[model samples]
Target: MYFTIRPARPADVHGILTADIAAGRTSPADAERFAAGISAAVADPARLVVVAEAHDDANAEGGTGVVGWAKTHHWDYADGPAPAGHYLGGVTVRPEFRRKGLAAQLTEARLHWMWERVEFAWYVVNAHNEASLALHRRWGFREVARGARFHTVAFDGGEGVLLSAARPQA
Candidate 1:
């Protein structure tokens, strides 16, 4: 199968959200909010959002459609004074598209984008998500920290980890 990867555009937000929801990684409302955030991120060159497109069949116009996405944020690692690093999150792939190497491609591209500006790239994965943990490991992302209050939404809280992959020196 052929894959086309590229930096996501503001107009791709809805398609991205749809893919995320289809993967069962996020709710409709959460995906909507994330879509808006993605648009804003795209407007800022510092933020990186990448997508992978795969063709459903041969001889199709556009050839492939969006199958997955990865987002990296240029934000502070800590609320207090400290050197800030790129935080990558919000990775999602359609259920039908899983295990097809799309996520890894998107990840590598996003990390490359991050390497251009930051010293390190980090990501948070829910502790219960063994699949994500394994994927991160396979990509050379090491665990940097662990915590219970890793993320909070409304009344929901979950355990997660901070993982980082070394970026090639320019």
Candidate 2:
């Protein structure tokens, strides 16, 4: 499906919350809190939040055109293999839009934003998340460490792998 990947806006917060809820990443009861958090991220000067807005024609399900979202954040882990630097924080795509390159596009947008100021990027993933791992590998992210947690970021019932990749040159 066609989508427009761009920097997120205040109006996009609810769409993001919708995506989060649909992906089972957020509970309906916590929607207000989640929306507030998304607002904060949208307003944060130090964070890069991007969203994939589905084209009107592509959103055949009559849902919000916001089909996916992603963000990059500065991580400072005092006790893990990951150092204080920019990281590819996370992404979420609506179920109907999954496996359609939306995730990669969102990731590319964030990486592009980061590469403007840094030479490297980092990310962490659950060891059991083979799909994400494979995607990161394709982006040239190599393993740096593995453990139950990366400082305060804990993996759910599995090991977490810290990965890093250099900025791609044009």
Whose lDDT is greatest here? 2
Which tens-of-lDDT digit does each residue in 16-106 have in candidate 1? 8788788887787686677777789878877888888876457355845678998877764563221266777667888888888887888
Error of 2 at 134 (Å): 0.7
lDDT of 2 by residue, 1-170 (tens): 46788898999998899999999999999999999988988898778899887766556454456889998777654464678888887789989889889888998888888888889888889999998998777779999999888756799789999988998889
State the C-alpha lDDT per candidate. Answer: 0.74, 0.85
TM-score of each: 0.82, 0.90
Enumerate residue pairs that collide in model 1.
none
**Could you tell me the lDDT of residue 151 within candidate 2?**
55
Model 1, position 9, has a per-residue lDDT of 87
